[model samples]
Target: MIETDKNQILLNMMTDYAKNNPDTIFCYTNAAILYETPRWEELPLEIHTVQSNKKIKNRTAITHIRPYFKKSKYKGFNVITLVDLLLELAVNDTEISAISSISHHLYKNEISVETILNYCQSQKQKSGVAKLRHLVSFASRLDESPFETKVRLKLYVAGVIIPVQQHQVICQNKKKYRVDFLFEFKGRKIILEADGLIKYSSNVNERANERQRESDLIREGYEIMRVMNHDFENGRFAQILENYGIPKRRYYGKKIVKKHY
Candidate 1:
């Protein structure tokens, strides 16, 4: 078989994969993440394409030639380029044309902003979507984590702009504890700690660790709010914020669709 024929065989595989897992976020930088993205796995899928490193107009295009394939604008309306499809999968705003252009690399298939949005809405309704919604809820409370990526998701929903993570703090003895979230408002240091100590062995050890951490923080004259895993999971995060003296903001009491087993 010729190389062209081999390439055709591969593209067909990718098309089949996409049809089955339409919501997976595909990107050049994160091939593994894309492949393992929810609902893509456990369904048995594969991607078929020609492997080439041709730089067209100073941009590297993953080139392929398949007769039956999805077409898009970025690939000149015949068949969608990998980049074009990636951009379509990454679509963000339906109302703003300017923002949609960011994903224009996948726009070649002539995928309209509306179509991208409809696909997104449908993707959000898939079986695991509820679990993902819970995950998004979990992620919103912090900006960064060695704990979990929950922080970024939490802030996004709460409309709380996240402070830089791992900001160092020195206690009176000069010992340091890197804080999870910190915000400076009205010259006060609002320190938020995602209490992930339960994963540590022994309830005794966990309590001791938290006590030491809190003592060290308090000694530094910083008011700290420690949030348990359950608070975020149960929609009690806003109350946790209030207990930390966040002054009852609007998003503090927002209700989320939480799934309970």
Candidate 2:
């Protein structure tokens, strides 16, 4: 029953915030009051003053002073921009300059606008860019995209020097296209594209464009290796290893999980 209450609280926060600000994105952290009990809700209103541990913070008054409270059917939290949240929080009494300053400060620390929005809607009072940075670090570890994360992890684990992502590729025609990952050795370029086949297919016009792009890339002598979601997931690492000519032990055929700290 206690767990159910927390879920209700979180749901309320998320639904209220979303309806009040339809343009704003809602994330779990935005409705994080449900993570702890009412007794632990009061953890110094200011984010800087708030303790890192959940069991230590007291955040009861958070529900009372929620910035958005028109309705009470919060389905879940979402991702939104900092600028939007600031506007929503302030409502008609918008503080433009102050919010811009805060947004600028957060962006400087590599905190995206989405991170700032989540922090603002959270229980912590006086939340700022600094605390937003901390939240971003915590959230990255909890990213939902498992396949992309694991591929990067597998490359790192096998001691392979993976190239930087979104690197630009210049073709013979002087046109450039950025790729997911690029590894340049001597004159040969090994391109690895992490293909998320959600909105793409071979029968569509987009596929035609993709074919042209690949043709142009191949014409430029790029040794491309398109790694799809299935490759890492369906136990096909051996095929990749052989294609890349990276000699592997018999253990390479087995599933490899990254044991990150």
Candidate 3:
């Protein structure tokens, strides 16, 4: 789990940057957070300005607004809109899955996919336009988490049949449980859950209830596979997938994206 201090850390960074560069606009994740609380991971501060003299120092990214964007003339310290941030993510070659998750959050709430697409389409000379379109191709409002998106990408890359996400299952006892992902293969019912640190606590009763819930699903013949958030590290994540007999496959996407986190 991210510490509450992360919000303060981001604020401090923005405050320090805005102090010296008054004309510069806090864009990217900084702008996104100004509009709404963060949904995924925290990122470094990004700023944009019409001035070309201000060079980006360590830990901060800088973009210069060209004449076309300058004509629009965004006002205030947070001049970049969500659409601008989306375009910046595209131009910056952000990791594909992270981009998808961010796109999901923005489009599902305050923006439309078409509005983003239309913006991209109109920006013929924009650096990240094509890249943004590729990233958005994988985006949907159904996104739940960055971890889930990573799981989906891993499944896609490994040539495995992607499990049904947010699947509903009814036990014989008349209780209904919503699962993260469900996979059915060769008469076997598999329930895959990705658990973050937020799921675990020191409370004994909570753990007891979790065990009981699993027992109920087990009694109904549904096999449970719980994946901790950290399990995605090292080779452990790949091993878990192979253990489930998901066949390995080659990746087909053209973009070469490295994770920002």
Candidate 4:
């Protein structure tokens, strides 16, 4: 709910509160923010905290009264352990949301899949342990954004061949380029780009730079497919992949019914 600027302000307020109240520990999303976990979005309405003593009555914050397995200090603030934050997210958020959050932090090297698995193993009887256990195997540290994770998950669920994320390729000109997603088909190297309009179209120079980069990649004999946010919203990504001859891994459940072009 909080925009970028507002989110920072809210976090600062929560940090100040944590510093003043030694008996309270920031947990859940609050702690995730303090830990600098990537792609972890906090609710703007309430600051999440865990009370170590008497509960505080506050409208802007939600207090959790529970025994945390571990605690740590980050930026001079008492915060819940990273493992606890992951488990909290797993239980509180949706499956994909939880997976994406964990994957982002993993990609940032703030946590490890093994650590999460170990925690899940120790808490097998917990509320979200089963779901977390199931999703952890699919989480990748290579995914750079929640959007990319969503795209990858959709492709996987539809039985499409999994592609490499943040793939690096050396161009003929001796310059290296990193692609969002890369696949190989019929001996052709294909690059799939997930483009966020705001990020790419912020200014004229940025747009031109991206175009030039794509041109260079194409010149290097790689087939490039640029997919926008709307494409996914309109179910166009599947058609795009199918047109490129990306073979399906296996057929189950409702098949990806191809539309006539």
- Candidate with top lDDT is 4
On TM-score, the candidate that comes out on top is 4
**Candidate 4 residue 194 C-alpha distance from true site, Å:** 1.5
True-structure Cα RMSD, model 2 = 14.4
Candidate 3 regions with alpha-carbon error over 4 angstroms:
1-10, 13-77, 103-108, 203-205, 248-261
Cα lDDT tens digits, model 1, 1-261, are 555454354445445554554433333222323333222122222231221122224322232223334533222213454333433322321211212222221223423434444444566644443333332222222232223344434554566644556578888787878887777666678787766544456788887987898888877777887666577776688666656655423454433333350
User: Is candidate 2 or 3 superior in TM-score?
Assistant: 3
Q: Give per-residue lDDT, candidate 3, residue 7.
A: 49
Give the C-alpha miss distance for residue 54 in model 1, angstroms. Answer: 34
Q: Report per-prediction Cα RMSD to one decimal.
A: 14.2, 14.4, 7.7, 9.2
Error of 2 at 176 (Å): 1.8
Task: Give candidate 3's error at residue 44 in angstroms.
Answer: 21
Task: Encode model 2's per-residue lDDT on 147-177: one tens digit a residue.
Answer: 3444554565565554666678789899888
User: What TM-score quantifies how close candidate 2 is to the native fold?
Assistant: 0.44
Cα lDDT of model 3 overall? 0.59
Single out the weakest 10-residue window by summed lDDT for candidate 4.
59-68
The worst-scoring run of ten residues by lDDT in candidate 2 lies at: 44-53
Per-residue C-alpha lDDT of model 4 across residues 136-167, encoded as one tens digit per residue: 87778988776677777777776877788898
Q: Is candidate 3 or candidate 4 better by TM-score?
A: 4
